[model samples]
Target: MPSITVRNVPDEVHRALKVLAAQHGRSAEAEIRDILENAVKPKGRKKLGSLLAEIGRRAKLTDEDLKTIEQVRDKTPAKPMTFE
Candidate 1:
């Protein structure tokens, strides 16, 4: 786990955070963590795997189609980049 130091927050913001924390039955630090988490990683965000699955569904792809693709697909590993 990592911690951060947020410096020079306004007094009003600090007070509001404390009040909000009290209302939510948590410490202000926990409230801040929740706020930060939500800001960075929100609930309604679309993930890549889900979006790709949705696209496959829209395209009416089936297991047989996937198997066909896999049968014809290249199996070689990509070479790593090199600098001389």
Candidate 2:
């Protein structure tokens, strides 16, 4: 394993990191390692736009079908929601 040093971090950031580490029941160093690992890792879930594009490709929707769907969607009125 390799070691790295991060110098001159702001006081507030250090304080916040310490607080977060305590909340997660770990030392600041462990919390930072976890944070770094998560930041570098790819997310498991696909983004909405990517999923929609894939679905459209699989469905083989034509330009005319898309135009008609857009027209219908634009003309439809939105339903109101009631909260008790």
Candidate 3:
């Protein structure tokens, strides 16, 4: 097993980590280990384009249906954003 030493961590960040660790009923070191593990691990999330493609595939939409959808979408104007 390999060990790592992290230095120069900000006091505010360290304090926050300690507080979070205490809330989770674990030591700060264990909390940090868990955080690192989660950060490095790959999360499963399907991309929007991929999901849409899959749905389109299952629906078996015709080329004319897709063309009509694009034509309708292009005709709709986008709403302007208002900032206070």
Highest TM-score: which candidate?
1
| Candidate 1 vs candidate 3, TM-score winner | 1
Which 10-residue span in candidate 1 carries the lowest summed lDDT? Answer: 38-47
State the lDDT of candidate 2 residue by residue for 7-53, as single tens digits.
99999999999999999999999999999999998899789999998
Instruction: State model 3's lDDT.
Output: 0.94
How many Å off is the CA of 70 in candidate 3?
Answer: 52
Q: Name model 3 segments beyond 4 Å from true.
A: 45-84
Tens-digit lDDT track for model 1 on 1-84? Answer: 999999999999999999999999999999999999988896789999999999999999999999999999999999999998
Counting only residues 3 or more apart in sequence or on different chains, how many pairs clash (N, Cα, C under 3 Å) in candidate 1? 0
TM-score of the candidate numbered 3?
0.51
Number of backbone-clashing residue pairs for each candidate, in the order shown: 0, 0, 0
Each candidate's lDDT (Cα)?
A: 0.97, 0.93, 0.94
lDDT of candidate model 1 versus the reference: 0.97
The CA lDDT at 63 in model 3 is 90
- Per-candidate TM equals 0.67, 0.52, 0.51
**Best candidate (score: lDDT):** 1
